[model samples]
Target: MTRRPAPRPHPANRPPARAIASAIALSLALGAPCAQAGESPATYLARIAAIDDAGPELDAVIVTAPSAQSAPHHPGAPLDGLSVLIKDNIETADMPTTAGSLALAGNATGRDAPLVANLRRAGAVILGKTNLSEWANFRGERSSSGWSGVGGQTKNPYATDRSPCGSSSGSGAAVAAGLAWAAIGTETDGSITCPASVNGIVGFKPTVGLVSRHFIVPISASQDTAGPMATSVTDAARLLTAMAGPDPADPATAEAGAHAIDFTRGLATASLKGLRIGVLRRQSGTMPGVTALLDRALADMARAGAVIVDVDYTRDPAMGRDEGIVLHYEFREGINAYLASLPGHPAVRSLEDLIAFNKAHAKDEMRFYGQEDFLEAQGSTYTAAYRAARANSYRLAGPEGIDALLARDHLDVLVAPTAGPAWTIDPVNGDNFPGIGAGSLAAIAGYPHLTVPMGAIEGLPIGLSFMAGKWQDERVLKIGAAYERARTATLAVPRFKPWSPAPD
Candidate 1:
């Protein structure tokens, strides 16, 4: 994998010390707005360009330029010229789809992943690829999110010093910072929802088979699916409607097509009325503020005429354990195939090459964390132990966890605090968390999970999740929209500030 140079700021927006000095000097010479009162076009252009020259501190994660081919046709077009920052793992014929590793950095397949093709077909602009955790954060035990060999480290737009959450870190950060109107994010476990929750955006992890994963870098074919992260539920739904469908490349699409419904239509404010919503009480016990937010949300839902059922998720941790095993085995096999599919391929077709690559480039790749997860994955084959673990995960997350509650309580959706808050981004120590991922049950069970911005702690956003049974993408979207409509949080755009002056 080769690391590409970061996209340069357009000359008009370049903010170097020299440029800032020039602007300051010009502003003084021209007397600012007084001169602008009847300024000529050239003067106006110069002034505007000066302000535009402010650089983003974390431009490594945000794509400044978009693809001309994927640009929308009109202002109110279906996607309305909305820019989409695709996760590096999701292929876009127009941009490099490196799965956050140097191994696949030079392997840009000149074909859009089906989801991306559909996004363009719906008039969405293909913005640059967002950086992610190397190999979707499947690299090591203490790996930091949003850091990739090819893309460097993606800083959180909110705090600048906090974690953005992996492996969809860039996607979440870009959308939350208004770098793009919406973005395509892929999730295997907490990839999509976790980042979205921390970034304070709407992250929709559709039912396992709901969205096609034809050209995306695979983790586990069983659980990987491309979804949307947006500033609002409506925008996310709009993007999802365009991306969900069957693809000849992925047989999983066969199950997705029948379940693919127009996710944006008929978003009713009363969608939650008469619905049975279960609260995952066990998940947010550590975060009191998060629990309070959920309590207020639950009361709001009840006021809107919904039934709430309190649940204890501790009844089964075995399910998560099993799913972890399946992911490990599947990561090895699936990533191996993805590596082999590259044009001319890599000298290392298996995980062994990756290990060697990291070893050789420890200064660049292993600066943050070791690849213990990859080592574990390499050691684990699709043995009987793997099968038993995978089976138990599905059985427990399904029949015992989700289905049991749904059947007994007659539930329509399950609600919980998606995650606590954005932890400080520590390159030395890695992420800090309470070990509560409520969306995992939905993810491992192939169900739909939607996270909407609830509020923030210290200006960093948090999200409330609403998960529904399999093939219930529409229901989840509808309920999420209702909650979003009841309350809204607008995210701020990132002000560009170069990491430092250009090295001579």
Candidate 2:
């Protein structure tokens, strides 16, 4: 666990005269953009570098490649001239995939992940790599969400003092802050939806096997998949279309070619009409403010002509416990295999090596929290215990969880509050995340989950989630697009204020 930085004044509360002057100067340096004008790659990269690295010090972007300035852009490509940021865990031929760890500083493989290759073919410029929770937040129980040994902490742009959520923290923050038009984020659980919700952006976690996972740093093959994070549902849909396809390297994606469709094709303001949406009231937690917002969202859906059905998510309470057991086993095996496959000799070649490295460099790597999870994972074996855990988790979370709820309610999709507003970042005690997140069911089931900005609580954004049975990625996106269009006027842009107490 890296040490937390000292607290700083909120930009709105009080700013030193010199700091204000410096911000003004930087803003002037970044000239205004023409409406709907296409940006040159060089100009796009420079703007990101200036805003993310310099002006607000968002710490979202880890590195930008020079080749981005010369990256090909075909006029007819769907994503032509669009700038996209890759989460650091995803391999890039040009940049090191550090996964926010000092141990992987030499981990550049010079081979793009299949997903990256698809994005390039669509003419999207890879702006840079964004920081993430070190080891994708799998290192410790008390670990901070967005703090990484290699890239430091990534602060939420909405409220600088709040947590951005993990492990796709930078991807969410970057897109919300306008550092890039969109970004790629990988999730095993709450990684994509949590951050995207708190950051007031759109995140689409596609159905497992819908997108290739080749060349991505692994967490669990059972749950991991990379998806798009964008400021709008339509943009996310478009990016998903470009990145999704069948890949020979990943057999899980064997059915992807048949299911892949232009996700943006069916998006319409009336898409939600005539749809049966199950309202998951039990999952939104005890926060009154969040519940109020959720109620309003439900009313909005009713007005949109969606038939709302109340549904309860009743599942084995041990599902989470079993999921953890499966992850520990998979993390040890997947990480070791991924490390062994790196192009060249790397310092941390296995899970055991990584644990030893952390012990050897405790001052830098474990300054605030120990790698308890890593140590626990090392003791796991892929035997009967692992297989049992996986089977139990899937059965509980899938057939007995989301599937049961949807089937009983006769629902096309289930809706719930993605999460509460961002929590204050605390280094000493780690993340103080509030509210219940509707990520676990979709994550464990390897199904599609989409989160869209709902509204805000004291300037911090809340999100509404849409989830469906596996392979319903298009349905989720279309519905989310409809909701987004209906609520666009109420959505508040981030002001980057310092954290303050929520109103009672």
Candidate 3:
């Protein structure tokens, strides 16, 4: 809820001239809720499916995620019946990983991505794939998140008019709307966390290499990693623990596996007691009503005996430019590798092919946005800028940022408002929200970051982020579980409606 301004003097007590101005100020201070209550998947899917027809057009999102078809039914597996929603870009044998574009619309992979394999090995059911921005929104500058030619647009369950906030839009919205128990989302920059934050769900972006990016579409191999999006931090940790490991297909896996740990053990409420947390004041000030919520959160932390150390932001030119350079170089390299792995796909086989297809199919692909980012990537080259930015990102978000603050302040973790309230979804102009994400440090550092539903803005929910340095997933999970227990908010689900009438 938005906060009210401090009370003003009584009209008779105050100077006559100031009465009108004070009233106006107070009225402006009260803002509307930015979020709406989300529905549970089991309840909402039937209704949603009725409003949204299920067919070939929207199948990619579901086909690529964990479904019964994708799972190995043998006994002894850990996640046997647990459903998973794979992002469209991740390869799945049963469905095409189109990256939401028509360029590879008819293409299908023969093998599952390493992460899906891991999910299956753990006994989870492969539910289906979730929709996402085409090419993870790297294809265009004005591209809308969650809009794709293959799956159309994924409407946010909270408000049909608001943007879902992502490249992982479908994954975030589906999980939050109760389409599944948990869904897998991949990120290059803010794809996973931003969507999770906006949707009021738990989002975890593991350290780079902690999860293999082998068959997943990439923007920058330097930063991209697959993580979990779920209803709670405990669920995210459970998924993360199952997915972490090495893959011979991805060299980055070596580093990740070495740092991987069973992140779900030692559940504790006392973990919050005496823990030191760095709060980045810069990340939380943009939205209305957020400060009050954060204040309450901080007070709760204090009562729990956690120490808060506020981090001061010093402008660093290098840090600002890292994500751009790294993504451009990686997009060019990653897309090419993914295409070659497809045995005999037609229509799109390379970035150039994707560009041509967009040009050829302007009415559908270019209906909302153009391929300017793809154009930019096409013209861009891997230069010293990329290497320099990579190093700076690692330094700033890692040792010089989170690690330095932790050691200096004797901290255990970090905290922030994940993102502000959900914004209205606009197809023509796209999303417009008042807040910024607070997960950049952990994301860029390749550490683990988790966001849980803190409270509602309007009727919609908002999230609070908890992050820790590499391999401290369990510590954060424990803290998150405690918060969930205290909050006791039930998750929402999508209500599916029937498509056609049937005779009895």
Candidate 4:
């Protein structure tokens, strides 16, 4: 037995360098698991915690509570051993759902949102809560994207000083930085996709009703939905599959069970072949770097057997004004309802209560921007004016917006740049997001939108968006997966570098 300690494994017996390298390359190419075998949830949390607030100082996480950490393994469950970060707005029994504001500091409901329960049932470890734009970026006009009173500013991992883009800023940054395998981010407008794009990750804003929004802090009931942000389309699709299902608490999800599909099923590189993809070229002009990347993406898709059709899709100018009206009406209605539904009395009981709390904590909450949007929303009423605005906004963004173009061109999906490169995080002037975004149409229409990493500009990542009609989530994910496969080689990984001024 003493002699049976066995000859200690030696470097001489190890596989050749070339052989080991080839094995790794093959594994990555085949999309095999890259994490070490039997990696513990604690191991992952430790790794992410090191970089989250200390190394790059991304400020992407609001809280990493002890209770959120998972124990050991659950091999039989769907997401066995996977770790997931929940956006701070999504209710978690163990952690506070701050929505990146000081007003809701101790608003721990001691209950999981329906979606979070689903994730837990599938064996996912709720790792922590990620920072978000305060009140999901609906608190003010010209507000900084990733700044929050509770979590400070979530920096873009690609460049420390660049905006991570909200309101899912931390969700996106955390996934992009490998903090967790995936994250849950809710989008009312561009909250999910914009941050996913700039952070160079796959963000899927599912059809509005496909995922239950029962416990999420609301921006708009008409458009808010929690989505999956992951490093790969396949992972995003998998997360979507687990999260999509009907919930009794949310009437909107009544049809979700019927519409939900195994999104990762039958995914192949040939998925793009013969598919008619209409290119949304109008929004590609503002950034030449982004335009160039988009042009290359179009060509690549064409070469991959996609029917490239140039479609002119112009958003109605009045849509924005109408959307503002609807959001304001809903924000006040939804936030009040959410506060009332909480089990314990929270610090801020209503939208007006929140406004006062911010006023009281001006030094922290109002350092950069005031709650103008909240003020405007508080004044809005759910009257005929609100109903009319909602109907008009939906009509313009749907039937007259994304729908018309797809129908005209007989296209399967519409493609556009998700957003421009990450902008500098300017607390004084706020977000200077210069490029066009395709999220508005799909967002207001309550349709599915998926953003996959396209490439980068000056080290800042950009994303290509694929969208389709309502409940066409599977189609969007499939097409996105195909494009991601083709462009995998060119996709850049994040380098936590600090931002620098442009050369003279």
Candidate 5:
């Protein structure tokens, strides 16, 4: 199970600096504004070139989009001159929408997901697609987070050999590495927040349906939503403002149009003053270094006039079981529906077809882990068991969980450690998640969840998550913006280190 990576500059020797500085410095050196349709700024191209020169081309980016660059850019647009990459699962008219699976190798339908269209209207350049966890990490039980059959494994910008966490691993890593100004990532659970946390970037998973999921590869319709992974909270708001709207094709988003607002407006005066926050002490886990950082962040918030109250929310065995059932039933239905809707794929129209595809191509697709999850989803049915599990799970996670806690404690949102620092990327044994994550709480409830760079553990970044009940998207983001401002000085920038603990 041993492997080797090409050598690169070690982070320990390099000074900790903002990853975006390389791009800005290069742009200034070469003169600014490399403007043209389907072209990136002069600095970004140079920055990408630098990475290419250092080692590999198969990092985060999979397919590059030149045709979409010709899309009309309205003057005085919200995101003019900005370049953004979307997860490969989200359909783009000009790019193949592969969820890092060989089954959808050449999916091109000449249509953009509504959220992607919203981005184009906002004048953002469609950079391309980023690699993700194969089938968004829903294919196998012990699957590696960043490795994919199509795009291979994405590395953490801070540590090349460390896990980036998925299935939005590429989007998070690309933004942190300055491959793009920002990127779009879809989350069914921690797909956005986990990768964003470990990559040392800001990741926001808005309430389900706030950003349209139309034309994106499906997981669970109740939980899937597209959001932004960016360098800062303000940048996230800018992207969210453009991405949120009602899409006629997706019924889930019928009420989303009404909630759409200038998300940036909430950031200008962002503050922690008079805010009541609940610290999920039970959920934050017990990593000594991580707890110290969380303590510091909470102290900073308190010093800024915020009230911190400790809350104990114990886990229930039933929630995980129900979620499994819910996802099992949903994955079968969702994947079948998505595949059937594709322009042409006669052989890959259902989950059963996908299982067959992997078996036929086992040498490539199942080189690391077998698709136990695909098999489970294939066997699952939308029976009374599924409905009961879905309802019970929702109740446990939403009204009886986060909502109940918030109401009982008179708090605005709950805070916890996003996850432990990135584990070493090991395909042989799969991911060794060091600690627990509260992403499932918000994810199951279809509420808003955001992770901000709190601090680092031996140069590995950790995130502080802020979660609130459903429809509180702006509120959740506003609170995160305030925290980001308070803790900006301590945030860790990626140093691009190689694997540590020695590969044995």
Candidate 6:
């Protein structure tokens, strides 16, 4: 889930901290069973330091806010008294937004991203930043998912030795472990969904234009969006209602004011009865256990009255290559502009400077892998090929991909396994995880995608994905809620196992 290049073409990774303001929404919407057994938000936050640092040693949280310790537990707004963790890439006036890198360790911007402000306006506490993949995993081909230069490695709460996935690794793990009511994670592609699926939580990647990208670290301007990660669909919807609104600075969000309404209002009302569901048979991966779980999920949806029909979706072999091209071109443009937009803080100012900073701090940043994607991004420029790739990729992924399938099948949403189970953490050779990804098409198309816990394999949680065309965020959530109701299994609780055996 990362990309950077100097030697080997880096894999790709997150934007910074998102905000969460859905505690009341969670309680009112779903009876708050996902809430940590009557624990107050303040109490949950107060213990985060102890839980994240010792014992299971999740390392999920990068820092904790002292103010949160004394935060009021009063009855107020919808998100009032809600505790949330921000990804380190997001700037907070009080804490350094390091993006899990040592280079921007001085990036105390003295301001909150608009998403954070929205959460605050809704009365949610800014609990502090969570560690992420270094530069959101845009450094090396073989880099570890949760290992960062500044925050070390983040472990899965389900299994200490398993992966939490990147670049929103900490946010997913923290939320799943009940370290916070919910956490915010950014996704250019798999940053949010992958980690959410990996850690057994619900992650929503709203339409890119639905949330403001201002004041956060850049990945791809076209694909990056900050969203909510929680234990339930209702909880995620609550945070998203707070996160969504028009931002004058973010041109992509010009339409957000119209489409972004209270997402939680109709979630429970969205019944599977008479709903036309399209099954992307080929896109669903072949991991036997994961496939079995997905099949069971589909059957569950069918029993609830969904009209499931198979859609033979075709893939353009070039989609992956083209997405890589677009990311490379955009990351170069976005990162340089983001660095220059910063206040007087000094360290790495551009991609070139960041590479140098990493090289200088090789003992930490380069200990596991190299910054080949940074080098690759540095070498890319505005070109006809880049433009062509962007146009084709967008068309194929959006119009000809998800949309074409829906229109042809007269379907409301598409379904698939969010991803395979979490692979063992291997910093030496990078992630060994596999998937048929319901994330990429929606991610590249800038559409709404949601993941909910389907079932667990060997005590490790995996998710079932629901996706739809642009601005169909509400529909996906409703369907997910319907599926959740249909599911016989309760939300699997993390037992903090040392490790889970491979599902045979």
- Which candidate number would show the highest TM-score if scored against the true structure? 2
What are the candidates' C-alpha RMSDs? 7.4, 4.5, 13.0, 8.1, 5.7, 7.2
- The digit string of per-residue lDDT tens for model 4 on 181-281 reads 78899999999999999988889999999999988999898999999988788888888988999999998898998998888887664368899999888
Write one digit per residue (lDDT tens) for candidate 5, span 29-76. 222111112235444544554552233332677766765445466789
Q: Model 6: what TM-score?
A: 0.91
Estimate the TM-score of every prediction.
Answer: 0.86, 0.92, 0.83, 0.91, 0.91, 0.91
lDDT (Cα, tens digit) per residue for candidate 3, span 215-251 = 8877887778889987666667778888988888889
Model 2 — TM-score against the truth? 0.92
Local distance difference test, each candidate: 0.72, 0.83, 0.68, 0.82, 0.82, 0.81
| Model 4 residue pairs with clashes | none
In model 1, the runs with Cα more than 4 Å from the true position are 1-13, 16-56, 59-66, 69-77, 268-270, 345-347, 488-504
- Per-residue accuracy of model 1 over 270-331 as CA lDDT, tens digit each: 46778888888888666776776777788878877788888766747678777878888998
Q: Candidate 6's C-alpha lDDT?
A: 0.81
Model 5, stretches more than 4 Å misplaced?
A: 1-42, 52-58, 68-72, 499-504
lDDT of 2 by residue, 1-504 (tens): 111122334655444556544443433322111112235656555555445555566777788876877777689999998888899999988888898888997787989999999999998999889989999999987788888988788988778889999999999887777667789999999899999999888899999999999999999989999999987788888899999999999988999999999998978544678889998878888898788888888878878888989887654668888899989999998999999999888898899899999889899999989898898899997579888988999988888778888888789999889988898888779998785767899999999999988888887889899999989898899889888766633555555557775445
lDDT at residue 314 of model 6 (Cα atoms): 69
Better of 2 and 4 by TM-score: 2
Clashes of 2: 1
Q: CA lDDT of 207 in candidate 4?
A: 97
Worst 10 residues of 2 by lDDT: 28-37
By summed lDDT, the worst window of 10 consecutive residues in model 5 runs over: 29-38
Poorly placed runs, candidate 4 (over 4 Å): 1-39, 68-72, 500-504
**In terms of TM-score, how similar is model 4 to the real structure?**
0.91
> What is the Cα-based lDDT of residue 268 in candidate 6?
73
